[model samples]
Target: MMILVYGGSGSGKSAFAEKKITELNKSGIPLYYLATMQVYDAEDEERIKRHRMQRAGKGFTTIEQPKDLGNIALELREAKSDILLECMSNVVANEMFSDAISDPSIYDKKVSEEKSFDKYEGVFNKIKDEIIKLKDSCNNLIIVSNNVFEDGNIYDDETMKYIKTLGDINVFLAEISDEVWEVVAGIPVRIK
Candidate 1:
């Protein structure tokens, strides 16, 4: 079964997803926390640390797959397990922009100096494929994602494309998910 838990920023979505996935792991099978975050700065590092602290002693074997889901081939093929993908938003962001972010001359380059952002469709397809493969490998798949379309601010073309991809991914996941939940103000509201 695939479950999606989503909400706006700071809506306690991560906590909710963790608790739900832990509760679902009743069979004593290996509970894998497939984390997809890439630490880009000090703040990101702190956030990652906080998340690790939150899930400490939760019986999850953390596999940090920043962009490549196929990295953990042995875990997927060896046994059936429950996998909690910590967040899809990070996965999408990492896939779509990690190259530029990792470039040696990144700090010297300005936004206008870089190439145009043209990989939205490709990144979206890649993310969908990764999710499908994850579903095939895990017994229960719990995905944490952010609800990013509600803000009224108008964004640039690249930002808009990113937003659209995330929205599309959410719709696709919700269509196939056994349970879809929207966390609001620390409350989990079942939408499907």
Candidate 2:
């Protein structure tokens, strides 16, 4: 079973996803939390700490796979665990803006020029494929993703690209998921 939970920041999507995963584990399957956030500053550290506290005593074996979901699939191929990916937005950002991309200078130039979305097509497909592989490797996959497109503020080219990519990923997830939900102010609204 695959479930996708989405909401804006602080919309209680993460909490809802956690609870749903726990409820779905009546058969006592191994529970895995795939945390994708990478701490880059004090605020990030604090957010991580808070999330840790929130999921404490939830019987989750946390795996810090900040990028490359396919690698996590490989590592957990035998576990048959029920996995909850904490957030997809961070994963998209990590993959799209990673320093490991070949020819960072050229990539930056192309991104800033806003020439073509195809420049990010490779990234989009990589993330989509990795997510599918991860889902196939697990018993049940519950994904948490942020809804960041509703904000009406304009952003820089690179930031807009990131948002667009994440939005596309979320749409893909929703289409493939057995169940889809949008959390609003701590309420889970079933959308699919």
Candidate 3:
């Protein structure tokens, strides 16, 4: 079954996914966590460390993939593993905004060009492909993504474009997922 737990920022999607993973583990089902975060700064490093400690204590195998999740998903299929992807939003952001973070000058130039935002679509496509393949291959597939559209007001042109692309991707994924649950106040309520 493909289960998608999605909600706005701080809506407890990660907590919900973790709980489901724990329950699956207790049931003697093998659980593999495909983590897509790479710590690049001190804050990120600390976050990764905390996540590692949390999952390590529970024995969930973690495969860190920051850019190429499709490759990792392919390998997991060959290995025949059941997996959970903690969150897809960060993964998309990492791939879409990686260069921007390194080159601050790109954001400095106030150019009203759509070309600047083209990479987001490609990143979205990659994420979609990987999720489709993973869902088909795995025994149980659970994907968590932030339901960010409900609460945000995109004022800036660049930010607005990014949010639109992300919202479109999220909606597309929700359509394909066997079960879609929206989390609110640390509780999951099924939306589809």
The model with the greatest TM-score is: 2
Error in Å for residue 84 of model 2: 0.5
TM-score of every prediction relative to native: 0.90, 0.91, 0.82
Task: Please report, in order, the local distance difference test score of every candidate based on alpha carbons.
Answer: 0.83, 0.89, 0.74
Instruction: List model 2 lDDT by residue over 1-192, tens digit each.
Output: 999999999999999999999998756689999999877789999999999999999998899988899999988889788999989998998887665354679676755674677757878899999998998898989999998897798998778988989989999999999999999999999999
Count the clashes in each prediction: 0, 0, 1
Candidate 1 residues 1-192, lDDT tens each? Answer: 889999989999999999999899976688999888888799999999999999999998998988877555345856778989878888877877777678847524635565454567788887788778778877888989898888788997667877888888889899889999999999999999
Q: Which ten residues in a row have the lowest lDDT in candidate 2?
A: 106-115
Which predicted model would earn the best lDDT?
A: 2
Which model, 1 or 3, shows the larger TM-score? Answer: 1
Query: Candidate 2, which segments miss by more than 4 Å at Cα?
Result: 100-115
Candidate 1 lDDT for residue 133: 77
RMSD values, in order shown:
2.4, 2.6, 2.9
Model 1: weakest 10-residue lDDT segment is: 107-116
In model 3, where do residues sit more than 4 Å from their true spots? 25-30, 103-118
